[model samples]
Target: MSIPLALQNEKFANCQESIKILYLVDDNFRCMCDDYNITKENVEFFKQKTEEDFQCRMEYETLSIELEEEILRYIAERTDQ
Candidate 1:
């Protein structure tokens, strides 16, 4: 599936390539449902989804940084041995 330009340029840019497509799909789905202002429940649902996506992105970044650090540490230890 083709990703939306906005998502490709923004939301999915920092994600690992293998997962970028999935994030794009989620983003597009969220955007699609965001245009209607018919009900409180819809707004709440979208809001909750946005918050969840934000949390997931934050966790991914944190884990990526931690993984990089661990890899670097492992390499250093190997070099010193």
Candidate 2:
């Protein structure tokens, strides 16, 4: 007995869908690995670096505001002189 053409096409379509699903999963895994630094000498290295970078940025913004205030004060003082 021979399989019907419609049944064979349906099977092929199912296989293609399965392949597409696998590709999607593989892509998602690669994206996650890239985001988290999948390979490292130390497991905490990326986390530590991210935290340190955040702290440095916060400190920099605070200092920048302070510097701007000081500059404005200096300009006002010189204008009054």
Please list the C-alpha lDDT of all candidates, in the order they appear: 0.65, 0.61
TM for every model, in the order presented, reads 0.49, 0.46
Instruction: Compose the digit string of candidate 2's lDDT tens values, residues 8-81.
Output: 34445756555445445676643543444434324567789899999999999999999999999999999984
Q: Which runs of model 1 end up more than 4 angstroms from their true locations?
A: 1-38
Scored by lDDT, model 1 comes in at 0.65
**lDDT at 77, model 1:** 90
Listed per model in order, the count of residue pairs whose N, CA or C atoms clash below 3 Å is: 0, 0
What is candidate 1's CA lDDT for residue 38? 36
The sequence of per-residue lDDT tens digits that candidate 1 reaches over residues 24-63 is 5676554553332235456778999999999999999999
What candidate 2 gets wrong by more than 4 Å, as runs, is 1-43
